[model samples]
Target: MSDEEKTPEAPLAAEAKTDQVPSSPDSPVIASATTESERESLPDLPATESFSGSEPESEEADGAAILDETMSVRRLPRGLIAQILAPEDETPVWIDPKRLGRQSRRDFLLFGAATAVSAAGVWWLLPDGTKQQWLSPAAASRIDSIEARFGVTGQRRERFLGRVLTFDDDVAEALYSRNRRVRAYRPSDVTPLRNNYNGRTPTGGYLVSWKLTLSGLATGKETTLTAGDLSRFPVRDQVTRLCCVEGWSAVAFWSGIRFAELLRAYPPAPAARWAAIESAVNLDGAGQPDPYYVSIDLDTALHPQTLLATKQDNRPLSLAHGAPLRLVVPMKLGLKNIKAVTSIRYTADEPPDYWNERGYSKYDGL
Candidate 1:
């Protein structure tokens, strides 16, 4: 296939524990955290760096007294709470007191009130003397007042808040190596999901007739390709894990042309900073108005491990696994590894993806 042959490559929560039992007589009970900006400013320690979790000799004597005073919880330094809650390996080297914002009495009171309200709701929902009502009238009334004040319906608020919350250390680590390979797996290790297909499944005959389309390249050119044309490029096979948001993962040997190679073969316009991948399946029947698609930054689209995957485990891709051609982006979450890809478009604007539109982050890396 040539530039003249237009083909679409179908492509592409945490809880706070307030256990304050001191470990040792000399150990401080409260440890603080730096602000997000301050943390950002510090250089990341080498993986070999280690801290014994011991205070400096100069501060050791005073640390215990400070610990006793802050152990009350009410007077606990806000930054200290975060350090106390974090696992030892993930904890910061040192907490900067200056980063702890001064919360006024009113702010403290409001937090206390919110905690009380939450406790009340939990208490009301528990069975008491066989009166297992889901919620007590008083609790429900208070909740309703809060909801009304926020002008948010219960379902909408829950879904929105759910997506916005995170406490996973792995997630934080993933950001640093968003474009680097993180895990590997053997062919047998690849998970075969019972219902991996996210949306519409392509027809059994689709692959035979499928054409890959490329448009909006830096060369001000367009191209269409057949499966054979893709094979003509250098092929790479990588053992990379696919981490899904649903909490399952599999390592599979994905074989295909590096996406970088594809881009080099069909350069996009210099102004293009984003690439959109569209699939053949359209479960919603929304048609052109709402075709299922996902977009990624050009840097990601060109990651060496990113592939126009055509095979899995040295065999042709199964239909359920985005047969024919699917995207393989090791650094990104599963949603961006679009299946049964049909077209690729380059643009200056960041194109939206199916999940991103709903609530997921645009950079669903790692």
Candidate 2:
């Protein structure tokens, strides 16, 4: 049969009515058409595109119009919007190697400079010479006043240079009556003469002989001590311990005239600040004046305990110890109390002390 003849004819009125009406209770119902305004108010259905190669031009135009409308509705470009919403990628900033190294070097240099300045300041503040602290200002001034009124300046340089002014021990023995006394020995009947003759001056009254020349005193001429002058000064006795810097100690009974009394006999200049004591022995053996000199302030010189001892242990001093006149400073160490004193000088400046020159403490006092 032909294709046109095989096609079914249109249904009769009854068959069409039956098809339009619901055949069963589970059948879906179809909406009836309304007015044009009502149809316009209904929600628009989504447009569809055909996948067939021969698409209608109107359909393509409609699709392009929709895409343009959607693009216009966006507030920003798609790429910009995506970037704003995307997670951030972070990178670390690196420090310059050169800059770090420079900072380190600067810190090191600053530290070193500070240390050097501190060291220099300490060195500058240290004391230069051996002037004792107690003899510094007020004490020295008092001594100067006494020296200026009564003390005479002597030849101090020769004493440091080791010039020995010798005297006979027999004279010292005759002066000290105890030297002639004999001690009885229980083992033998022989009585031995109490002679301690080591050239050390025993503790007793003895005259200290030294050439004193004062430029400002007595018309600037040399003044000599007369025998009568020795007789005028009264003698006193004292017992003191002599402590040497070398760690030796000895107790000796010293007999001498007070240094203050002797100073009153001859006066020094008013400008005198320190009293220098010089020993006859050049302890350093440098042919220079005895290096064993001590510079005392005026107050220490005038102290009641200061003496020019001529005897020791109730006998005339031996030569090995300081004979004749030796300085006895009770408050000071034995080294400061110079032995064999040959001269005394009063000066404004501090004099060189013996042990201080040998790296010992200058303030060697009790």
Candidate 3:
């Protein structure tokens, strides 16, 4: 204990000479010689030291004060650190990269606000107007209520109810179909009159009368026709042929009354059988209603010359020919003759005739 105090203090003589050295079985001995100078300046130290034990510097300062009291205490368990930072029933949990970039910018602003509300609801439901086929304000309010109740003006002639009708060439191809400029009034130019007569014939005294009326008769009932019911209905002269399925032909002189005497003064109901009629002018503007509408069969509305005219040749009937009332059926064709008779439906089916629903040929009678 005297040769320099038994040769010790060189850092306690290198910590008691590495605590009496004896570490080998493939070495890993660090018991602190200042942790072997921090494991030899950390060149990843390890070439051998096999640890055993000894005061190894108070067991390396009580194992570095129990690893600094287990790294300052509070180890895990707040539900295991919220289940190891949350997901592990076999891995997924990543998200929080700032909530996945705020949920992909709130799903790209809700897919650009649902594609701008589906392109503004398809430009507010389309359809505007310019006439490629326009007319739906209830078919332009039924052609402005039949040209404000049957337009009338002036023009004079005088013939009323003469008879003997017949026009041919398939009634001039159903009233001018392939439109060869209205096939020039075929059926040999014209000459077929008398149908239903309600007369007053005195030629030059200018009194050609012949009236018959029935405003709107779709069963909603409303009927009127006087002048003593058109002279108590008898003068029905016969000579028919106004055959005009557009092809055109006009003998002219259809008198009045007889739509089987105004459908027997408003009868229709033995399950009727169809007889649409209705006209006033729009013919094809797509806005429907005009000297157009044709559907028949109630055996041609009780046929005995099916009329409702109001005079044609001697006078009275004028608004371009279908005055006040017009519908003469001498076996049809001439679009079932409807012209300003407002309404008259008695259907047990088969109605929709305007040019047979536009494609033509619905018997269109002879």
Q: What is the TM-score of each candidate against the true structure?
A: 0.57, 0.41, 0.22
Q: Return the top candidate by TM-score.
A: 1
Query: Which lDDT tens digits does candidate 2 get at residues 1-366?
Result: 654455443222223233333322211221232232222211211112111213443344323433332111112224556746755433232445655465457557878998976754443333322122645656545544444354321223223222221133223323433123212122233222232222333333333444322232323344655434554788877766656656666556678887778767766567766777776543333334433578766556676677777777657766556665677876566677766675677777777886667555554554
Q: Where does model 2 exceed 4 Å of error? A: 1-222, 226-228, 281-291
Task: Write down the TM-score for model 3.
Answer: 0.22
Which candidate comes out best when scored by lDDT? 1
**Candidate 2 global Cα RMSD:** 40.7
Per-residue alpha-carbon lDDT of model 1 for 68-154, expressed as tens digits?
Answer: 321211222235566466444443444344433332343477789999878655544433322225557666567656755656445
Give one clash count per candidate, in the order shown.
20, 27, 30
Off by over 4 Å in 3: 1-261, 278-292, 295-315, 323-337, 340-346, 355-366
Every model's Cα RMSD, please?
20.7, 40.7, 33.0
Q: Write the per-residue lDDT of candidate 3 for residues 1-366, one digit (tens) a residue.
A: 565566544454344335433342212333333534433322221212222334543335322433231121122234545636743233233334654565456558878998976654332223323211465766644544443354311111001110111133346435532112112233344575433212222122112343333433556565655446655766554446667655656566557777777677677776767777665332343433344667776665676667777776545566545556667775557766765455566777876776655545665665
Would you list the C-alpha lDDT of every candidate in the order shown? 0.64, 0.50, 0.50
